[model samples]
Target: MLSKASTARVVIDLDVPGPAISRHLYGHFAEHLGRCIYGGFYVGEDSELPNEGGIRLDVVEALRALAIPNLRWPGGCFADEYHWQDGIGPKADRPSMVNTHWGNVEENNHFGTHEFLALCELLGAEPYVNGNVGSGTVREMSEWVEYLTRDGDSPMVRLRKANGRDEPWRVPFWGIGNEAWGCGGNQRAEAYADLARQYATFLKDHGDNKLYKIAAGAGDDDLRWTEALLKAVSCLGCGREPKNIFQAISFHYYTVAGTWEHKGSATDFGLDDYYRTIAKAQDIERVIRAHSSLMDAYDPERKIGLVLDEWGTWWDVEPGTNPGFLYQQNAMRDALVASVHFDVFHRHAERLVMANIAQTVNVLQAMLLTDADSGALVRTPTYHVFEMNKGHHDAVSVPVHVIERPEAYAVDDHAMELVSASASVKDGRGLVSLSNLDPEAGLEVILDLRGVEVQGVVGRLLTASSPQAHNTPASLGAVAPVELPVNPASRGTLAVTLPPHSFATVTLTL
Candidate 1:
């Protein structure tokens, strides 16, 4: 319990470098489901909107602006049902198939391996391809890798050159399967581990391209899955020397408003719903800690990393949208969620290698929302959070000690702090991100920089009058970021006040 008059003291040690934040930690995900690919990214060159080779220019620019390090593609569940052969060679000759996992919509195979690699090149992001392991065979998965990375004279290499790219594309990350416990065949942990080992064995290196294979890990806090998979992989040698086959294990956790079937409304929620969502989002820290602890039992050397491949808030679909589309609006609540997640990731930078928020556009927690009919694109509140926190990317984590913490907001025993924060330093500059989740009460954070020297400070704040405040094509800039005033410190300590339900990033020159 914290006294109401007590101000939070954040002590940042500037000299210590806790961990080097992986640039890949700030990653994004794009799936073939809904308009995430067709209208959200690819609008075709002939469309009235500005595009390059059928890909929307505005979307590309927005992603580039974020300096997104890596992007996972092809599916969430759709990856399992997808076949690589149907989406390559010629556009006219490519086959069309019904996306059974999604809305039963027909996929024309317009965007395939080539398109995805090209898009990654455009965005300067590494392409993390999810191989089809549920229905496709091992040969299909192996050849897809060969087709993309084989620079030598091979049959697949010839096809790639015939398709237009003479030079091979580098694919650094690959997923054996997604959601193996559910949409990815529903196999138990042992069975999925067997499948992962087999697929990883065949996913070879072509030329200078080395694949970092990620096995499908537990969902939420299922430590059994982690234990079973790691135990199974450890015994791969079978009475001989043991071998760890995976470079990383992936965990998927989505923050749903309530139950899966009746997830509450996206923009029509009250304070209870808002606090419940924050509590749900904070549960991710528990998931990461528990999973990492399980990994430690088998991977004590810490060679293997935890990849949060699919994460973000999943609310009920917007009204009138296709039920399977999974489209939802981003609000001020989402900004707080992003801030909290980013802080958690920074705090756990040692074991957490990468995290890709689910569905980057017009889909779950999307940074950019697109309107096909009106040709309108609006950056959401989450986008501002990402942009503001970009300074922390690749920065060394600074040890932050929070004293006199704010009391938790409790609702039925589920509690979270009113203020969340993380700090980092890079290039002689200190960066700190703080989120005040209180809906009505502002928090004044006192920075204890007794031994550290700071020349100047600048800040940016993102907040709105209502938690449901969001950006729409009709009402753009409704919940954007604004510069915050940073007063000079007194007695060798800096102070900044955060408004209720706001996320702020302060940068200090050292």
Candidate 2:
């Protein structure tokens, strides 16, 4: 933990570069829950808002600014119940179903495969489709892949052509299921692993499109589930080369300030609750390290990948909203949570391939919030964090060593570090992201940029007067970024003072 005035020394080794930080790590997720789909991204063909093919043009424009690399679609849990066939064809003639998983709301099937793909096209992002394993057949799963990626004549290809698409769309990522231990299906890990193998076996590649099949994996702290999956999939002692049954394994972890039944409020949190939230957010590093170790045990060469498909802060929905809608306010704390996660993510880039923040809009820790009545869009504080860290995408990860730091604060009996940061280099320039977790005090960070010639450094800072400060429709620029000055320290070091509960990114001209 850091005091009101503390200096932390961090060393960045530019020469000892780690793995390339996959651009897919900065991905977004759009599900069929609440306004995230209906009033969030899609406003119908007749809305007053600027739209292209019924997709919100402003949302597209805002996300494109972040250079969002990939998008996971059709679920958090909805993918299991979604039948791809029902969502395709004409919109008016499409059937409706009750969304039993979320709020028991009626799904009118307006946004489907074609609409989602169109949205991805508009945003210039790759689509990662999650298949239905809880209620659909293997043949159904196989044909959906064929319908989306297969070229030339086939049963599903003909059906896709008849439905209006003349050519196949390129889809690279496919998920077998979601949360098999809970909402996806209450199956054991071994049972789900066998099913994953069977389902992935038929996900055929067509033309130039190859699929990277990801199996729905363990929940947070479910090490036995991960070990069970490794045992079911590993072919080490079979005396033959191992086959890629699934390209990656996915797990989910959400930072919550309280228990599941009583998750703390999004905006009205006290100082103790805030510190507890930070401690919970930092715990993801332990989860990632544990999973990575198990993966290394099964495949020493690191052939398989680990995907944190679902992550972010989960708070009690704003008062008066539907509990299942999961609508919450974004604050500076959410931004710090994101910054801490990215710093941890940069450290594990070797095995961590991709991650999608729990949602993109109108849900828990959303980037954008939409007003259904007025069709107004508001960018959240979390959005600015993604924008500031965009330079990290696909850049070589440079190890950040904390030579000296503040004493860890005790939050709910857990040690919480106040200063967190990560560095990456690309195209002869370097980007260093820094975050101060203190809510009331500022900290001076000294950067020891090693193995690189220092030329110049420019910085952008994101913070507000209060930790609870956020952006609303009336005040969209409330918590945005401003120019931050980087000063020349003694020797070849660079110095910058980060305000409490703030995030900053410095560009190094090397």
Q: Best candidate per TM-score, number?
A: 2
Error of 2 at 313 (Å): 0.5
Residue-by-residue lDDT tens digits, candidate 2, 172-215: 99999899999999999889989999999999999999999999
Output candidate 2 Cα RMSD.
1.7
Query: What lDDT would each prediction earn against the true structure?
Result: 0.87, 0.91
Error of 1 at 124 (Å): 0.9
Work out the TM-score per prediction: 0.97, 0.98
Best by lDDT: 2
The 10-residue segment with the lowest total lDDT in model 2: 234-243
